[model samples]
Target: MRYIISYVSTVNPNISNSDMTALMDYVRLNNNAIGLMGILIYSEGNFFQILEGEEQTVKMMFEKIRKDYRHHNIIKMLDKEIISSSFSESRSSFTVISDHYNQSELHQFLKKEEEHNPEHYKSISYLAQKFMKFN
Candidate 1:
């Protein structure tokens, strides 16, 4: 069955974009080897992400992402099978440039982000970058 996985996390303030890029590069490489469905990431005071894929693929990918140091306090939002993946394929990712949310919307999104126990937003963000580059 298909599933949607949303996550949130905290990153060290000193993290640089180049470093982040390299880290995401690794995630994209690994996700390609595995079966990463769709990915989206957003950040403001903290980081957030959403991933959609098969059960096994999503679970396996989340497991691997937890070991990475780029993020801490990762949490998931939605983790159930939906009618379809939000992505065109099982290996696509996208960046959410507009993460600005109203207070209520932010609260709702965070509630969802906290419930599903996703990996890290950085991983998802990196995946989006790679996906966009390749796609």
Candidate 2:
């Protein structure tokens, strides 16, 4: 069965750009190796991420994220048994969305995609936007 989990977290304020890049690279490599498809977005000191794959795989990844020291205040926003991942269309199964992104655009894009799928999960990209507004 496929499963997806979305979460929001505060980036460690002291982390440097190079550090973040290293973190993303490490995560992307691991996720792709395990056939996970997802997006990790960092905006203005916060992170919004979604991960999807086999149920056990997704859960294991989330556990690793929870223990990761790069971020804090981890909050699981959305979790569901899904039919498929919204990110499966990407050539790279795992991607890092940072450097530049439009919050409203991202929200609308995810919302629109969700409309075409089973309504088993709620969209949390809005919360991603809301979190980015803080700092």
TM-scores of the models, in the order given: 0.55, 0.72
The TM-score of candidate 2 is 0.72
Instruction: For residues 1-135, write the lDDT of model 1, one tens digit per residue.
Output: 887777767766677767765655565466555666543343543555565667887876677667867677877656777775455462254323223322343333334434443444344435444433322
Summed over model 2, clashes come to 0
* Candidate 2 colliding pairs: none
Model 2 Cα lDDT, one tens digit per residue, 38-80 = 7788887888888888899999989988887877999898888
Model 1 / residue 26 / CA error / Å: 2.5
lDDT of 1: 0.54
Per-candidate clash tally: 6, 0
| Candidate 2, residue 121: lDDT | 26
Identify the runs in model 2 with alpha carbons over 4 angstroms from their true place. Answer: 89-92, 100-135
